[model samples]
Target: MDEGRPIFQQIAERVENDILSGALVEEGQVPSTNEFAMFYRINPATAGKGVNLLVEQGILYKRRGIGMFVATGARERITARRRELFVLEYVAPMLAEAASLGIEPDQLGQLITDQLTAGRLSEKETR
Candidate 1:
């Protein structure tokens, strides 16, 4: 749990991560809010709030007699949203910094490629 962010948000992200990683497939049941509360030592209401965030986002759905389940296309929705966030939070800032340093887009591309190649070589050496 990150002290800097709300616990409920972290809880929601954990479920999203699970879905994105294929641990929670579409239509698969998710743990109850009570179970989440017990696991994280949080209030049931707090856990439900986290779960509800996904419900509101269409990432999950509820059945009257059953617990929550992942919604169809949830993984795709999460991936698209995360990609947008990545560009907003990381790529934009990196681009601005590169411009400030007089690094052209082409130079940045080459630098990125170089780093990736170096990383692959290092990984191979370790293996």
Candidate 2:
């Protein structure tokens, strides 16, 4: 798990990102609390907590006789909600830091391009 913030919150975001990106998807069966806990090597309660956040947001809901499933429109709902976080959590802060350091636009573009290229190359090597 990544550092800072509670692990459960991070797990929640990971699940949300998966849903938004068409990974988990709408009406899909979310991983059981135990499965999530075991997969992430976290406490079952922590996994349950993460899943519960989505339940509250209507991205996920519990079935009476079964486990949790994604809400019918979870993908679209998560996409709209998460867009706000993308700017505030990532882009805005990066821009502020770039301005503070006097990094030019071209420099940022080069950095991103290099990173992406390196990432692709690294993936190819692993494959």
Candidate 3:
């Protein structure tokens, strides 16, 4: 966990990462607040705050007696939300930088393609 962000946000992001990676499926039971607290060595209230954030976002739901479970279509919903965030967080800033550098759209496209291709090639070589 980075010291820069709140622990609760980090906990929420951990669950999001799990859902995106298929480790946590829709309708699956999530770790209880106590479980999270024990695992992370944090307070139960802090863990509960993270879990509640997901509940508010419709990512998780609770049964009266049972624990929280991942909501149906949570992955799809999260993916869509993250895509929008990616555009705002990454793409917009990249485009702005490219414009400031006087890079045309086509030039920026080619640069991105080249970088992607190089990365793929390097990965293959490492393997």
Best by lDDT: 1
lDDT of 2 by residue, 1-127 (tens): 9887899999899998788777886888988999999999999999999999989999899998799899998888887877898899998999889989999889998999999999999999999
Residue 51 C-alpha lDDT in model 2: 93
lDDT of each: 0.97, 0.90, 0.95
In angstroms, give how far residue 43 of model 2 lies from its true place: 0.4
lDDT of 1 by residue, 20-101 (tens): 9999999999999999999999889989999999999999999988989999999999999999999999999999999999
The alpha-carbon lDDT assigned to residue 85 of candidate 2 equals: 82
TM-score of each: 0.96, 0.69, 0.93
Pick the winner on TM-score between candidates 2 and 3: 3
RMSD of model 2, in Å? 4.3
**Total clashes, candidate 3?**
0
RMSD of 1: 0.9
**Candidate 3: lDDT over CA atoms?**
0.95
Stretches > 4 Å off in candidate 2: 90-127
Name every residue pair that clashes in candidate 2: none
